[model samples]
Target: MYKVIFRIKGNQGNSFKELRQAGFIPIYFRKNGKDEYYVTLFRGKDLGEVKEAILDLSYYLSKNGKYGDFNFATIYEVGNSNLGKIAGGTLGALIGYYAGGIAGLILGTLGGIFLGELADIEMGEKLVGVLGWPMSISR
Candidate 1:
């Protein structure tokens, strides 16, 4: 997966969280004279796939910015990480365990309200990750 950073401008109508839930990450910050945001999109590592994604992003970015009547920043490559077999299992276990714990809490306060709350938080964090919320201190 590739992690990218970009920005949205002049969207009094759309919020970051909303955009994120709609399948875009918003890692934005105020720097110099402009506001920028980030987005991470999952794609195949092949060059053909990368090029297609780029073209799609260019169109989407342009359209999204136009919705607000302002030009948005282009994406910058921040970093990349490999998701091997271990990563898949780890991620599944993490999400499932927390989800089960949360359900247990909501059903009967499994371990305690504290644990429930912790589980809720963990679930939220995982949801953010699954939803591709940009990782940044600004948010």
Candidate 2:
């Protein structure tokens, strides 16, 4: 749950690639003005390494003369994406069983999967969008 929190300003598409290379599984990251985001990377318990990645990213950005302010670099232990998805799916299946019998179960599970996937922070910053979870950025 070593969740990396940061924001990108305007368009810097290559940052996503660098982030992936930093051992972070991209959950949801896209070009935007500025917004806090949680990536699927923070699996380990080492904040030093996480901070290094952030520093590396900052250095990289500085080299390219991109957005210069990499502030509020912090680490967080966020909820597991797989666990959250499974819970969502299971809850969906249960609700489906009550709503439309077997068909509902299938539909609900599928819907749940989609919702779960959307809920996936592994794909990049998607958690904030799907669940409205406030960006856990800290200094």
Candidate 3:
């Protein structure tokens, strides 16, 4: 399975949704000292299709006059501004996971590999504060 992790500087929530909707499953975790989000395309029968779909999105954001130059910074800023306030809450967490699931569906539509036997996608299982304090998160 190929993995691509992009630094999200925005809403850890909505961007989760957007990415999920794109079919790439969201797996949240931490490494070193940074919080990380991973989106993987492993179930695809066609790697080229997956790559193309993601590239298409990137291209749309890059050349779409109004949203042109949309890159990591833009994604981060938007996600932060919109989803930042939803850091902690039972319902918020559910919403985040749902977003991830929907993204998986979207990815399916875009011809990714998140299908049938490979539909296992979800958010990370942790609720540490920005300070990395351990918190309880019940499934």
Sorted on lDDT, highest at the top, how do the candidates line up? 2, 1, 3
Taking the tens digit of each residue's C-alpha lDDT, what string does model 3 give over 50-82?
554455434333232211112321111001121
Candidate 2 residues 8-110, lDDT tens each? 4434344666566566766655544544344445566655676566656655554544443334344554554575578678988999999999999998888
Q: Tell me the TM-score of each prediction against the true structure.
A: 0.33, 0.53, 0.31
Candidate 3, TM-score vs. the true structure?
0.31
lDDT of 1 by residue, 1-139 (tens): 3343444444434344444443444433443333445444433454344334544444544455522112232333223322332344445445656777655334333234334433333333222111122222122
Better of 2 and 3 by lDDT: 2
lDDT (0 to 1) per candidate: 0.39, 0.57, 0.34
Alpha-carbon error at 81 in model 2, in Å? 9.7
Span of 10 residues, lowest total lDDT, candidate 3 = 73-82
Candidate 1: what lDDT? 0.39
TM-score for predicted model 2 compared with the true structure: 0.53
Give the Å error, residue 118, model 1. 18
